[model samples]
Target: MTQFEINSDISVARCLSPSFYLDDVYFESSRDHIFSRTWQFAGLKSDADNIRPVTLLEGFLDEPLIVTYDGELRCFSNVCTHRGNLLVSESCRGASIRCGYHGRKFDLSGKFLSMPEFEGVRDFPGPEDDLAGLEIREVAGLMFVAFDPAGSFEEFFGPTLGRLADFENSNTAVSTSVYEVNAHWALYCENYLEGFHIPYVHKSLNRELDFASYDIRTFRFSSLQTAVPAELEKDSGRRQEFDGKAAFYYFVFPNLMFNFYPWGLSVNVVEPLSPTRTRVRYVTLETDPSKRKTGAGSDLERVEAEDQRIVESVQKGIGSRLYKPGRYSVKQEIGTHHFHRLIAEFMNQGGAR
Candidate 1:
């Protein structure tokens, strides 16, 4: 059944089915059912010097999309209305977008401006000739785009913006690293959703964090995982006032992770390549450059290596005939439970969007 139900009370709830991790049919269905309706990171407002065309979820959605600006920035389908040729093949600055194929032109804001050789066309330059615009929301320099979204921007990400109100100004570019992992996309996400494996999986990280005091707080479409540093680590007095000497990890709904440290913000985006493969992008925004050398955020490469290896191993193990769903560690699995419920609810919905 598509209705993969989970009990509201975590006390006796079973984990998500093994089939959800293995079947190609389910994997393909999730693209339209879940990802298409969710808000996705398009690019940063500060990312371009001019009008830029970007593909949404490149390998998966592969939707031709363009982000352009005149006085106002807009995100619209990048396909030419007359011939379906890509409108903007590269990042370039111009007052308007012109398809190289047939010279159909649109304003930078995506309004149909002119078309050559279409003088006799019926209903010429109607709304259909204009580039179709998607639902886009811009906040804190990040551009988010979604198609027939299941929820509003505020409903999906309001709490995150509220907590990170001070971060809006650090919209500058930073280091970005992308890693390809041989793991289920959800496996990478489930591992990131909770901190239960930190003590066992991340030895160096465990040293800086106080295990007993670490906590997970859940929201409507997101969850926050916070770890108070060990007393000696905190006593060093290098942290900023934000998060009050704790490292905050915010997991937004399905696949995005915002990791905050005194060093800055780390945006980890999990992109599905196939049912058993995933691409994880680590983007670092250094608000406080000096803090990069220490604490839970430091040595990210080492930590990422550790997380990736284990997740890949789980990817292999999940396909076993003997495999079965297990129980949740009620105290520590709050975020995973919330995630599973969302998967079920969203996936159960039809692929209309």
Candidate 2:
């Protein structure tokens, strides 16, 4: 077993070991030790459908789930209890969920309703006959589910929960896109944890923000990185809308980003496909149409392309035999350092909390 240790002091700490990214053993370990125990964005909430089926972290954890809304929203296993068959094929309104294989029935609340041709069986319907209900939390019009979360929802999202209040019922999704990157999922997230590469990788985005005043704040399970518009640096009066902030980037461990811009929110969900391949889903919601194409949020696809290029290059570099872990920049890489520490803490723990 390869153990990862990141120093507590930023000035003395180094990045996560290259083995953590390049080794299959570590990748497999994280599937249960890290991703399985953290909150993940299932999907955006919708009133149009009463029962929505979602596969949590498809291609990775691959846990099938169903989010049903009666008067309130709840999440349950999409698998049938009797024969382990899938219950819901798609999102639709129905009075009950019946297993196609055995006709084991479950109500919207995931309680066992009835089963056919089982009258003679003793102790047939018990606690295990009902669908397993999982823990779910709603934040900013997005639904997040966890099998066994290491911490409470408030501990994970408390620092920035108030910042997203206005978007609770108002996520007007304009577009959704998926980008495939031939790099480790953590590499993509590591690149996102800092603005140090913005000047070198994202020339267009670098021009929009004041790099000197870039701010980073880390919480127990989340971090915030704020960028100020270059124009706002000149005239501080116009920056009052969102405290003169051009972009509010919030990263919730282990793979969710809530990016708030003047125009709207872009929710980025990073899904690990394999040790070297990852899928990034971009959900673009427009909150202010007038502010579109104006600031740090504009031309997002181009920015993503630039990020992909550099991250892929790093993926290749880390595989070299002579390569070694590098030190972190105390001022510019706090978010990245915090993320590494959390990964180390979870990997070293005995089991999920």
Candidate 3:
């Protein structure tokens, strides 16, 4: 029941309290307070079937959902209204959904179609019998759904749309990788919000990026960090078309990372399994095959290994009785500070809608 607050002034604002990461109470509460209210990565529209089942936020929210496309794509509760049975267990081509449990059925749009053996039932097949619908937003070829979003999809992703369109499209080669971390989700995210530790933690990455020109820009529900290629990379003519930029790392509030490199996009969706455990899914889209192994995006595996090592150590350190919340480096940690402030604001809100 504790409300967290972060100082607005980065000059004096301490990092988000360790309690936010260490306490079980906050972790459970965040399922609704933070995650549910934010837009979550659903899946690629290109990969969806006429009827596909998706579990929103997987281990976190775990809301069983069915994405259907008749003339248009839509989302609905995968649970049947009659007896709460699961409607669609997997992706299939169908004009309607039939609950294998009770033989109840609904159309692709989630409207109640028919209920077998309920011919004489009182108040039978009313609106309550219809499947519950949810809102979905499609960006590029990706799909996102929210149970109760705090803001519009545009507000959450608009800033990057213009630039994203150029690099992400149907032709991109998509792949997926997942890493389980023995650390709080916030630790991993905050680590990504700043480049301050690059020189200290990632020697190889540091060599490829111009640390001096690293820039962070904070938006309403997201933040962007641009890394300029090192002189050697620029001289190689690899980053010429990008006008000296090597990477575009984007963080959507709560837990979504859209990292754009010359090769393609790497999306990290942070899933909370427990207070001490987290799952980070890497959805990679290769736009330019020739550039896949070049620039800052090339050595992702090494950089990720290094990051996991450092963040896991911080996880252990924060649990120490002697440790306290630390202050932010105003010049280097604006993105991190902004993230902490958003966490405080969302966590302090009333119960989730």
lDDT of 3 by residue, 1-353 (tens): 77788999999888888899999999998888888888899988754478999998788789999998876889989999988989888789977888899788799999998877887798876898888899997777778898788888878775776666775444788899999999999899999999999999999989889999999999988999998888755376655566678888988887889998877788899888888899999988787889877778889999999999999999999999999888899889999999888889889983233
Query: Model 2: runs farther than 4 Å from truth?
Result: 350-352
TM-score of each: 0.94, 0.97, 0.95
After superposition on all C-alphas, the RMSD of every candidate to the true structure, in Å, is 2.1, 1.3, 1.8
Instruction: Give me the displacement of residue 350 in model 2, in angstroms.
Output: 5.4
Tell me the spans in candidate 1 whose CA falls farther than 4 Å from its real position. Answer: 171-173, 232-240, 350-353
Best by lDDT, which number? 2
Descending-lDDT candidate ranking:
2, 3, 1
Model 2 / residue 161 / CA error / Å: 1.6
Put down candidate 1 lDDT per residue, 148-219, tens digits, no spaces.
777787777746877556677764457888999998999999898878999989999998888888899888
How does model 1 score by TM-score? 0.94
